[model samples]
Target: MEFVMPVFAGIVVIFGLVKRVPVFDIFLKGAKEGMLLLYNIAPTIMGLVFAVDLLRSSGAINVICNFVEPAADFLGFPKEIVPMVLLRPVSGSGSTALLTSLYQDCGPDSFAGQVASVLAGSSETTFYAVAMYFGSIKVKKIRHTLVAALIADFTAAVMSIITVRFFT
Candidate 1:
């Protein structure tokens, strides 16, 4: 398996030589373009990382979870998974930490842990994806993308709970 990539690369180089293609020049051009794209998107990625750290360190996620707990309970969602649900859309690492905590506090066989596991698998890091993709292309106006992504995340959370409950 480790040799597959080297073999494939050798074949590509051989084929390019046969076709008289400038493989080295093309490789250099692609590498330069990738670096340029990274340069263009670096600021947005940094801002997102900073904001996620601020929210986590400032206890904003806990505050939001507290505020949402009642509504979540009323809607039949597991209140214990509130932090994971809230953080899942914005930061994958944050939600993963929250999920690990849930597993430790509630046990993996518990309802909350099961729901968190399902939610983690089913949902996307919507804000991170949108920021990275749009930032790479320099699209300043996202229109309804944020709203649509949030709605999808919410649906995934709800369905995760429902699916877990249905099976268990």
Candidate 2:
């Protein structure tokens, strides 16, 4: 695996040389463009991160969790995963941390662990993705993208619970 990258890179360099392409100049141009794109998207990344943090530190998640506890319980989901359900779409790292905490608190073989695992695999950071993608393209008219992404995220959670129940 370690040798594969170097070998592939060497082959690419050889191929570029044979094609008379200015490999070094092309590489530098690509690097500069990548840096520029990163700069362009930095604000979007910061904004999303700040929003997710605010949702966490402001106790909004807790309030929302309390509100949803009854529905979650009736749906056969646990009381502990309310925060994850809310956060996964907004922030992947936050949800991953929550899932890790669930694993530690309930052990990996436990019901919560299995459900958390499924949720982690099934869902995505919808807001983060949308922010980055749309922000990169400067798309002001999001239309129904947010609604669709959130719906998919909700479906993932429901499916995770149902699937876990069936197998576990």
Candidate 3:
């Protein structure tokens, strides 16, 4: 079914291209607009990255992970997933950085590393989504959404770790 779907999509795309539907020009225009949007948002992304790095270098992240380690273990989670939990709220890039470091420190096949990978994969970029959404619409009701999204991501993380550990 999936193979047939792709073949159908390819046929449609080829048909569109052959019919002189301005696909290339439309694509280039879309790409240009995307690049412009990216350029405008680059500073915000850089600032987010800097803040995350500052958190890491100033020992805040470590302190957080240290305090959460016992509770994490109590919940049957690996201790190394603590940073992933903390960074998930503030910055996705930060969580990814921590995830990478955990992978390197623990090695990918270890239980801790696999669990970290699952946690990282399961989480979302909460702050980035809120910022982009509010920024685009110029609306500012970001009160409960953060809490809700974090809860969802936490659920995803727990399920992902359990599933990956057991089913894989």
Candidate 4:
């Protein structure tokens, strides 16, 4: 009975004679348009992805990570947080991959692994999201957006680790 409402509505739409064309045609056309949109946006997405790749491969990430290590340590962060910090800015997937490695190294049920998982889940990929969305819409003014998003990500990362550590 719960699902019957949708089936009944679909039947009426397909069998009704006023429109004459099958309703499936409408869905097909919408799907085709969505595919076209993806194609148009692929270039911008690729550019963001490649820029992240270069950051990961260039050794610059390690240099930046070192500069922040002292402060991160003062905050009680594990040494591994450096790469997580760097990767979070450039690529979401790459960061997740590093997070996975951390989980494997520390064991999934260990404190560090659990904290990393929480941080990974809670934080946003601030730069990548802004770049992809702005480039897709051709918006040029991104002055404060990235800064705000990064602040939110930082808050989430810190709180995630704290909450996970305290609760479990």
What are the TM-scores, per candidate, against the unseen true structure? 0.83, 0.87, 0.75, 0.81
Q: Where's the lowest-lDDT run of ten residues in candidate 3?
A: 131-140
Of 1 and 3, the candidate ahead on TM-score is 1
Q: Which ten contiguous residues of candidate 4 have the minimum total lDDT?
A: 14-23
How many backbone collisions does model 4 have?
A: 0
- Candidate 1 Cα misplacement greater than 4 A, ranges: 1-25
Tens digits of per-residue lDDT, candidate 2, 35-90, equal 99999899999999998899999999899999999999998888778889988989
Query: Which is the leading candidate under lDDT?
Result: 1
* Residues 1-168 of candidate 3: C-alpha lDDT, one tens digit per residue: 769998986886788799978877877898899987777667666777788779889998899888888888888887777778878877876777778888899998788888777777776787777666665545667779878987888898788678877876
User: Whose lDDT is higher: candidate 2's or candidate 3's?
Assistant: 2
Cα lDDT computed for each candidate against the true fold: 0.91, 0.90, 0.79, 0.81
Q: How far out, in Å, is residue 140 in model 2?
A: 1.1
In angstroms, how far off is 9's CA in candidate 2?
Answer: 7.1
lDDT of each residue in 94-166, candidate 1, tens digit only: 8898999999999998999899999899888999999999999889999999999889998898899889989
Clashes of each: 0, 0, 0, 0
Tens digit of lDDT per residue, candidate 4, span 75-149? 888777668866886788888898889888888788778778887778778777787778777888988998788
Sorted on lDDT, highest at the top, how do the candidates line up? Answer: 1, 2, 4, 3
